[model samples]
Target: MSASLREEMELIEKHEEILGERAELLEQMESRREQLKLQRKQQVKEGEAARRRNATLLQDLQKIEDCLRGRQLPPPTILALETKYWASVEESIPAWEHFLQGKGPHPTDGPGQPSRRAKQQLKTHKETTKKTTNDQGLPPRPKPRTAR
Candidate 1:
């Protein structure tokens, strides 16, 4: 009878160990399930962000295409160039006013208006400067040389 009792006690301990192992396995499975759920949620959020960004880009591209399709720009015209030059001059009114306040020459005619002879001399001077630079492979002078 004592031997039978010892065998029953050993069986009880073995069953207890098995139960403990099963409980540990269940805990590990629960942790893994929670990790998988979080990963899935993050993946869903990233997909939603990508969709919104794609939609915004598509809307912007469509607006740009619509603008392009709406108007045909006029061909290049002499009037356009003259208008642009006049606009530049109009925008420089402050600078021109400042110059007028000074004792220096008018801004419209920078320095004195070159005479025909002076203009011819300047053209020749530019030609000579260009040739010298081409021959010497050096940069042109910062200031044009004036006759003494």
Candidate 2:
């Protein structure tokens, strides 16, 4: 064979080897791309599942709040408990007043400061008492005894 022909044949063989290496590299790249695509799809699925779980938790929280409100009673029960509490408080008032010598709520206020409704009732009672006394041939009430 001539040297020129042999050089040409060697170049052809080198080109073929480069083409084979390129094919292998391309196959590796394609496999890596497929793996990456599958990993991204799994990540997206996990994210969607987390979002659904959060939504379920939010719904459960709302249900719990609703149940709590449903179980709550009105102010009347609280008021009744308060009244009992105040009666207990009232029991302590006299002893406290004795200890404090009629100072503060035990002595001065003494639960005597009436609520608006109670004061209105008292005013009506006083007016009725005055009217009945006037109708009778009786003097007006002697200085009314201060309620204890």
| Model 1, C-alpha of 134: deviation from truth (Å) | 21
Best model number under TM-score? 1
Score candidate 1 by TM-score against the native: 0.45
- State residue 75's C-alpha deviation in candidate 1, in Å: 7.5
Q: Residue 22 in model 1: shift from native, Å?
A: 1.1
Per-model TM against the reference: 0.45, 0.43
Q: What is the lDDT of candidate 2?
A: 0.84
lDDT of 1: 0.87
Cα lDDT tens digits, model 2, 41-98, are 9999999999999999999999999999889576898889988999999888776767
Model 1, runs deviating above 4 Å: 71-148
Model 1: lDDT of residue 77:
93
lDDT of 1 by residue, 1-148 (tens): 9999999999999999999999999999999999999999999999999999999999999999999999887667966998899999899887678767874445555455854556778999999998987879766679988999
